[model samples]
Target: MSLVNRRRRPPAINIVPLVDVLTVLLFFFLVTMQFKQVSVLNITVPKIETAGKNEIKEQILIAVSAEGEFFYNDRPVDKEQLEGLVQLAGDTTPDMPVLLIADEDAPLKHVTLVMDLCRSHRLNKLRLQSR
Candidate 1:
């Protein structure tokens, strides 16, 4: 046999398939992802002695901070817009109770304003948030 050596082919690395698979997975996850907003109402509910036991659902939660900032379902609302906001939420869940969750240090007037909104909307099943 001749002493001359033949050139060997370089090893091949195929990344096309890997890249395609990764792209497909990315698209799948993007399309299947669910978008939902879960608003949290941080509050210290007032304690009560004569409160009754009841099942509450679809309640419109209102929150007030210590600074007297008003929030309905975690969204800030101007005093002028209070009525419309409460009415809209109550209308959506007509039978649901209106729950007011106010901070312990919140002004009594702020808490009272929320109660007033609920009362004006004719919401009977009002509940206060508590620790």
Candidate 2:
């Protein structure tokens, strides 16, 4: 009998498992992804007796305290810079509403001044503070 040498063959490649795992990962990411962007501010507004729930689109909250202090979304701002700040905020979202939240004891002149500024800027949506 003649002696013969036996050679081992290499293993076959399998791509199906790899493709399945990749597809699963893709689906997981898509399902868990969020598409919305949210912006927020922290400020205390006065409560009003006649306050009603109103639908607010995009808003730049202007806060005024009883001490005649002015704030842009909880951040203190210089009274002289009110116009500039309002312009900047309006620029962020051109058509967004302006919400003015003044404390019950806040000076009326402050609120009126803010409203006048908004009107001058042609920002039509204006909401006033109450209660």
Candidate 3:
């Protein structure tokens, strides 16, 4: 009998398919992710025993900081600028709701001032947000 020697080849791993799958997963996550716009200021809203959710299609958001500073749509503004923004919003939408998101430590006077502004502008649909 003749002596015969055979060399066995190692199996090859294809990385192209793995890379394609990872890329697809990455894109899927990016496409389905929901990003929320967060404010820079630290705000802790007060909790209430009785609070209901009111969803309005079109509304303006006003944030009042603990220091009584005003922010319209996340941008800082003075009283005059706030008034102008409110007026513009009212002109665009007659009965658009105004949502007031005030910090828990904010003074009552600040809240009252915002309410007064809304009342003066005839923005009757006003809602206060709390935790």
Task: Quote each prediction's TM-score.
Answer: 0.57, 0.58, 0.74
Ranking by lDDT: 3, 1, 2
Query: RMSD of model 2, in Å?
Result: 7.2
Give the number of colliding residue pairs in candidate 2.
Answer: 2
Clashing pairs in 2: 47-131, 48-131
- RMSD (CA, Å), each prediction: 6.4, 7.2, 4.0
Candidate 2 lDDT (Cα, whole model)? 0.76
Instruction: Compare the candidates by lDDT and give the number of the best one.
Output: 3
Candidate 2 stretches with Cα past 4 Å from truth are 1-50
Q: Give candidate 3 regions above 4 Å deviation.
A: 1-13, 19-37
lDDT of 3 by residue, 22-108 (tens): 999999999999975566867788998799875675678898999999999888999899989988887777588898999999999
Best by TM-score: 3
Which residue pairs in candidate 1 have backbone atoms (N, alpha carbon, C) closer than 3 angstroms, thus clashing? Answer: 45-129, 45-130
Q: Give the local distance difference test score of model 1.
A: 0.76
Q: What are the per-residue Cα lDDT tens digits for candidate 2 across 1-131?
A: 33456565899989999999999999999999996523243334677688887667557778877788888776788777888987776666567788888877778898888888877776768898554
Worst 10 residues of 3 by lDDT: 1-10
lDDT for position 95 in model 2: 70
